[model samples]
Target: MNGEVLVGILGGVGPAAGLVLHQEILRNTLNDGTDQGHLDVVHISRSSDMAARPAYLAQLEAGETTADDDHNAIENPAYGMARSLSMLVLAAEARSARLIVGVPCNTFHASPIWDTFAALVAAEHADHVTLLHMLDEAVAMIGRLAPHATTIGVMSTTGSRRARIFHDRLEPAGYTVVQVPDHVQDALNDSIYNTEWGIKSTSPSIHPRAVQNFQSYAKLLAHMGAQVAILGCTEIPLALTGSEIYGMLLVDPMVALARAMVRSAAPAKLVPLDIKLPRDVHLGKPKRTLSVRSDSVDLTDACETLR
Candidate 1:
């Protein structure tokens, strides 16, 4: 563990979501081990129940915390997610983690969740625990990867769409967002909740049908003039890794967030040149920089690919 920094993952909102983010963080932490050894990460694989909309609403509407209330069972989505976040930070702190990053993007983009997280973290007053709006990172990526695009495609959870995370974030910045049509949106919902793209699906690999359906939407969005698609939900990108749809680059918020983790937490000596990302991003070691595009993406060619 690096004495100066420790990064924590707030995952398991979906079974695979946190784990995939954990692996990505792990691989980035590989290559040149740090003096402190591998980058330390605390992962709390939360129960899917925590993200259950119906139960969460039932609990929220039931009102006011009681001694009997189990946060894990009855928490509002945001509250439960925030509760997990704080606990992980506490764990990371014990290990001398100077920074903590929440993953799966949904927790950050969801309504009241972001608001609640802000309120909760403020109460803690720990500057070391870090949280960035994934929407903002996605926007920055669009500016670089599809600089001229006036409209971008977005496919995410029903809750995220209702919250308007993409529209609210993008429209204000002078960009138009192309929302998936209802039928396309239904397909998306199944891919995330009912199919292999879903956390409930056990296997890490997305099924061919799910992949094919996802690409169909990509093609549709492209025909609609959306040049880039933002995998707004953290779960979406996990399926699309190494698969670029109709040549449209995907702006994965997790990847951007991971890049942020490297820049903010990794020790200065280990970071090496921005373009020449050192192998051991955490531990103090030197190896050839893996070449990925320098633009906001610091990932290597083998990892962060557009195709």
Candidate 2:
């Protein structure tokens, strides 16, 4: 255990979402069918430690928080994330020499929030933890899963979409990005944030309405000729747990992030992409076709294919 590299998760963007990421790490890992064979992982999820990601982004965009207002820790979700990351870093370092961490929240990855959190990590926890970019990993997964796919659809929170998180990344990479119109986005948001049935509110047991809304919105993206759809929000995968929607391949960035963390910590322990996915791991089928061999493909190869 002392010689092992630990996988760290900066969780609590939403508690259930964080647990799903932790589960994905375990699911994607190549274990010896025993608890001991699994990689060491440190998952810290103090939901209260962080402000709501969407609310924070909304505030930033509304000019509720200014560029120079570094003193407002309560309004800035980044400070909370950095603090959680520090705890994660400290915990991971006490157990291993190296730590690879991934934050599961897509909205948190928006520039205003991510840049601030990243700076804090670089200043304090940089030497202790290597944070993986969830969006980049997901984009690369699309490349690996569909090398010829040129149009990518994204389903995320209003904050993430408003922040142009996926747009800023995918458009520059030469892929056409598809998103729902405002009304559709509102329905999409309801599926994840609605108090009565939102995935965030009732995860581990999805409401049928939430699933319908997600599939409905995804079909809209398919109508726009999207060959692939990214479940950009961390809570989204729970609501849409299928490999494809309307012939569009559904790719979860969290899965990519988990696989990447395992690769970085211990490539040999990383499971082959083609391995039978657990019931909830959702990639349509384990035997689906691939441009790269399931046995040979790794995160680096996937990202390179995109380039």
Candidate 3:
């Protein structure tokens, strides 16, 4: 790539979402006998904490009244989203990136919030910084992939449980949305918030029961006339990676987003950029003494040096 591209991820909506974005970026870049061809990412992982807001919203949607303190403890999705957009604009300006992308598929909060976020980026008027939204890309891709399909089921978080977010955008293109029932919706929320997406889990296995729950839910939607099922939440894809859930074509929003990024960035060679770590190293956390190496060198020599 002639010009450097900086991907601004408003992550931390959940750790799983952030990790998925990173993995997608890595998957897009093709190794071309070079060190760096993958798009540079300036990821802000703190936003994942905003997931609490959605969980709170789910309770309210369920007709349960919550205390102000409980509400206030969670980050306002609107404010968190705005902050994330601002961060992306600032990063683009500072880094002189050619493009900026935000990966928030659960479009709850408010519609005007997205407009405001767009306006903020437009005000910067950075010629090279093209702001991209994952939801729009995903919707468009699904349309092209399943043109004849009528009803599509969406599996997203409680925050984005509203049908308008997907239907408002997809209906005009001649598609209808079918979502999980309220009870099943609650189960999905628990699976993600308590087990996969949340930090409280002691044993975070894939949880076969969760998969069966989702599969059963998908079948129900299919029985209700949904031609395809869209895995709206980022965490759902990780859970349903290899399993074959019958009764509808399964579509993953994250996978759609990745395909869009690759198609959009075509002709720009992608190369793997591996950041070596100790066997037990964890990402984004500090470690003890360490060595850094680029992709262009021989690891054998580096190992000898370390020895």
TM-scores for all candidates: the values are 0.73, 0.85, 0.70
Count of residue pairs whose backbone atoms collide, per candidate = 4, 1, 7
Candidate 3 versus the native: TM-score? 0.70
Error of 3 at 303 (Å): 59
Clashes of 1: 4
The CA lDDT of each predicted structure is: 0.60, 0.75, 0.57
lDDT of 1 at 305: 27
As for candidate 2, its clashing pairs are 243-284
For lDDT, candidate 2 versus 3, the one ahead is 2
Best by lDDT: 2
Stretch of 10 with least lDDT, candidate 2: 288-297
Task: Report each candidate's C-alpha RMSD, comma-separated, in the order given.
Answer: 9.2, 8.8, 14.1
Q: Write the per-residue lDDT of candidate 1 for residues 1-307, one digit (tens) a residue.
A: 3556767777766666677666655545534665455666677877753666534434444664433247455555666667777787777767665765765655346555567667777778456677766677668756654567677788777667766767887888898788667755866777777844452362455555555555566666666667667777665654554424555656677666655565566644233323321231111111212222111212233122223
Question: Candidate 2: where is the Cα deviation over 4 Å?
Answer: 1-3, 67-74, 275-307
Any idea what lDDT model 3 has? 0.57
**CA-RMSD of model 3:** 14.1
